[model samples]
Target: MNKVKENSVFFVSLLLTLIFIFWGVFFTENLTKVTNAVYNGSIDYLGWVYLGTTLFFVFFSIYLLFSRYGNIRLGRRNDKPDFSTASWLAMLFGAGMGVGIVYWSVAEPVTHFTTPPYGEGYTVEAANTAMKFTFFHWGLHPWAIYTVIGLALAFFQYNKRLPAAISSAFHPILGDKIHGPIGKTIDILSIFATVFGIATSLGLGAMQVTAGMHDIFDMPNTLFVQLLVILVATILFLISINTGLERGIKFLSNAAIICSVAIMLLVLMVGPALTVIKVFFNTTGLYLSDFLQMSLRFTPFGEGEQWIASWTLFYWAWWIAWAPFVGMFIARVSRGRTIKEFVIGVLIVPTLGTCLWMSVFGGTALDLVQGDHSLAKLITQDESLSIFIFFDHLPLSTLLSILGFAVVAIYYITVADTATFVLGMLSEGGTLNPSNKIKMTWGVIQSALAAVLLLAGGLDVLQTASIAAALPFAIIMLVMSYSLLTGLKNETVMQKGNKRNTQQN
Candidate 1:
């Protein structure tokens, strides 16, 4: 009877993943209608949700780093850094911020070039707002969400002898006696959410790559091209996941991020470096000044509602949606890490990457527009055209621009690859060592989802789907908060006893 039930659980998990894959590809158009409504409905408090999450994380991170809780070590039998700290941070950030940062480094700045929300009146160096907005999006708050879950997963998995699954965090509520079918159900939901959430990012990345390619090469955007890219992404991730994080995924992440850094340096030298720096700081200043007001504004009228729903709210929901997949990666890598090290690394280093990237892509677009009367307005005419206008002003023009487009293409693949690997882990009952077959299956699932979303209208569908997945997780996050708080309270006593034993001995 128990064996039969175990097999049944596996079948149900498999069924959910297959269903999501189908939804992502074939039914994504209809799926988008449902998802967009959820997106629209979330708008009323989505801004506050993001702001509150950000603030809680900032404060929580401070507590973790400075308090005794920071010293808490996790993992089996003994506590030490479970993974190399640098490798750990890289994987976590690469999985979490990889695609969004890549797409926005250019798209965001271009959006800001014409009518930056805060300082629409900043006449001279409007691109400054572009850089600042990048910081805001990739800053401390977003990382906080990942950090909270990472801490919870690591603590419970290690100290409590639980699997590193989201439901495992609820052990205090359900207890070990409630394992089996109940536990499997939670695991299934996590897997389903992780797969769809990641596919959403992969799909969006593919579309951005498509648009960027169209601008650079004048190639027609077609389903055939998108599918080819998706397949490549799946294969890359399958190889990486099979090889596991220590070998393949680590090398690939390091290489991809390094290549991106080199591209940014190239843009800095050729584009207006001084102007980019200045505007980046300028945007930062403006964002800080208006942070609270921007955080809470409902903006229920005109494009205000539309912008908030599509732009800011979309970012909020997307981050929330991605919370599970990315959050899980962070948790896995964070074993043996002091809370202080994990929190700071997760929050601060990634923000630097985000700021610089925005400076490169956004600043370049702004400079092209500001320097040339014709290109300035062209930047905003269509998001797809901004890259073309900016490249028009580059040193090698067409050649460098094509390479730039290729950079984005590869970046998307990297994003998809990481998403595929992570989703595999989720489906494998959050096992520390998941099977390669599971990884490959999830990879294929995400690829199919991306294809469906792209064919249905690109990122709009992806965004809608991702946000809807997150709404349920919002409730999950809340439940997690109480469970984590209870766990941390118990951990405090355990630490005191350990200290006492050492002193008495």
Candidate 2:
């Protein structure tokens, strides 16, 4: 018999997810209304909680880099990183953000430019604010959330020889209870969060791919086309997962990084290069200067409250929902690095890269929108197709559009493959090498969830479902942070005691 039957975490999570997906499919209208209400209620009531927790994660990540535990390696003292620095960064960047960067890079800035948080639409100020907040949304806070989870899991799994699972991070606090109901609940929440998180991404990627196909080949942008995109992408990912991480995920990631950068460079070279460079640095500076103001900006008495709730709060919840999958993937590739190295690499590198990408893609798009308001209309019509429209105005429009489509497709595969591996691990008692059979099962579930959500109500439904699923996982992340601190403190005390005993002997 398959060990899945013996794994409560896997079996229970699968049962619950199936029930939820069935509800979503059969009662699309009711599920959509309920999920939207829950999403809004959580934002209205727990918006502050989201802001406060995200800020704490950011601060805590920085502290880990300089703390006494900084030198503690994730694995044994003599172990080195399993992958090259370039490969490691490629995987991190590709798995962590990937398709969203390409999809949102232009679309987000244009949206904010037209309806900024606190500025006139389509003006220079709105353009500047759009890029700044874009940087803020895609910046360090999200990575910090991932870092906390990744560090905790890696520390326990490698340093302390615990199972490679989110629940294991709580062992320091809950002790043996981590293996009981408490631990199972935490792992279950992680699984739900990972599935919805990846499903949302898959849905978004499908729309973008459909839009690109429409833009390039004049295909109809209908639900049927979008479902087809998801089906084909899922099949490709399932095949990719069978190759395992080393040959499949790693190769796809490296290829994605290269192709994505090429598209960015083409935009920079063909568009206003100097303007993109200037906007990037300026927006980055603004982001750092207004980091606090942006992080905690909840407008109770102002008109911008809805905007903050929709954009900022949504991004925070999405990142938290994604932390488990991304964090676990980071941990898997980051076995031999120290806490300091891992923290700095995760928190700093991907963040700066995101800023540059936003600057180039977003900057160029914003400039075009300002000059010709018609460009902004394309975005309002369909956000997914906006990038392709933006490409139409630049040099090598046809080639860049094709490249953009390829990047989205490859990113979808990378995310699905990585999620399959991580979800399999979570369900199968944290086995480092989960069965391919289990992985294929989760792969189908993920694709099914995305397809159902797409049929239910498209992007809004997808976003609402992700935010709703993320609520419990947010609490889990907070507890994980506390447990990590406790674990590190205990390790420090043990080190000192051993040092004193050796000296006395």
Candidate 3:
């Protein structure tokens, strides 16, 4: 009782989360109808907000890199980065977007080739458009969204000595009111977003893992199997949580990166190597040239409105929904770095790597589909089987499938472990190292949520709900960016004043 009173954020959030899971499980249809209605409404009415906010974040990150505050360290002036550059990048990349990239690397490009954002489908133009849009979705824009929140959190929580929570980022605007109901409200919203977003991902990853197992090992893909996968994955990730961040997350992240690179190399070597190189360069050029037009592209008067809403708007909302979780994880690992370095590292490195991965897998998948119409149709039927189907035409098919399966599974563990850690941190008064009991509670809750949604057929609805949550959170993110700028300007003035005082002395 004392603990519950002391940690009202955790208890209230937990109670609400349980209620949500029950509603999803017992009243799946009603939940689906409600979430879909809200989702479609958001996409129909406020889609431009998602697009414009993300575009603003991209420019905001760039401005910070060039602004006078570029040299401001996230921590104290003399503090150094706790982790090395390579490990830092791996953790952020793995936590931010590991399995989703692998799952979509082949699936999304192939989907676009068949049903593009614009123009006729399955032509050379469609394939070119596919790669260009893939780059756009997985590239700088998403990372810029993450950078906005991460930079603000790190700057305020570390540099300004505020509490390590989402509400802390608003200290410049709210002052001490950040510790009142307003702060609790922000944290609760973050918790809801984190729990549902990750639960949706867990459910999706479980389904994809089941698909991989079915394709490779001839296992049955059923609800029971998916639940079992969640059970096993829950155990693995909880074990990782127990081992803590330095040993568990770091090791898994590094391993996942290595495995991912090896898989990409194998595909490049065995697939159309020259074509991939050409497509990467050519598509990169298109991405740059079409960046501005695509950033705010919508079919207000044309036929592509459905496509824009389905793909582009949906992706923007999903990324924003995930910002709190990924942003906090990145901020936690990003102490003791300069603002400019953090922006460049976050916005550029992983994006280049992601574009290359897409060029390899997505490029190769597109190449393969040109000659095999049946394969394209099969992939269109079920995107989860995309990587497996792609591996079927290559040499060492079985080996590639197994390796791909391992990557997805490892990604599952890393992401779940990171989410567990972040949730515990948020609920435990923003402690850097939350108690094992708290982490365990969240881990089990997440697993249960995934299992319940999988069985009740509420995963898709929950995902849509997550997207709906994005509209409000995007507003919060916009305010956070302003608050961050305010704090940075104040720091600049303080530094100048201190320097002048020293000179006079």
Q: Between candidates 2 and 3, which one is better according to TM-score?
A: 3
Candidate 3 residue-wise lDDT, 302-398, digit = tens: 7999989988898999999999999999999999999999998899898899999999999999999988878888887887788898899888889
Which residue pairs of candidate 1 clash?
Answer: 80-336, 128-279
TM-score of each: 0.88, 0.96, 0.99
Over 73-155, each residue of candidate 1 has an lDDT whose tens digit, in order, gives 66643777756766666677677677566555555666665666655633564555556556666676677777777777777
Candidate 2 minimal-lDDT segment of 10 residues:
455-464
Q: For each candidate, what is the lDDT? A: 0.67, 0.89, 0.92
Worst 10 residues of 3 by lDDT: 377-386
lDDT of 2 by residue, 1-505 (tens): 5655468788888898888888877787787798889988998999998999999999999999998899988888799998988899899888889889988888899999999999699899999999999999999999999899999999999988888888899998899898888888988888987888888889988989999999999999999999999999989999999998888999999999999899989999999999999998899889989999998997777688889988999899889878999999888889999898998889999999999999999999988889889879787677788889999998899999999999988998899999999999998888888999999999999999888878877446656887777777788789889899999998888778988999999
Instruction: State which candidate, 2 or 3, has the greater lDDT.
Output: 3
Q: Judged by lDDT against the true structure, how good is candidate 2?
A: 0.89
Model 2: CA > 4 A from native? 1-5, 498-505
- Number of the candidate with higher TM-score, 1 or 2: 2
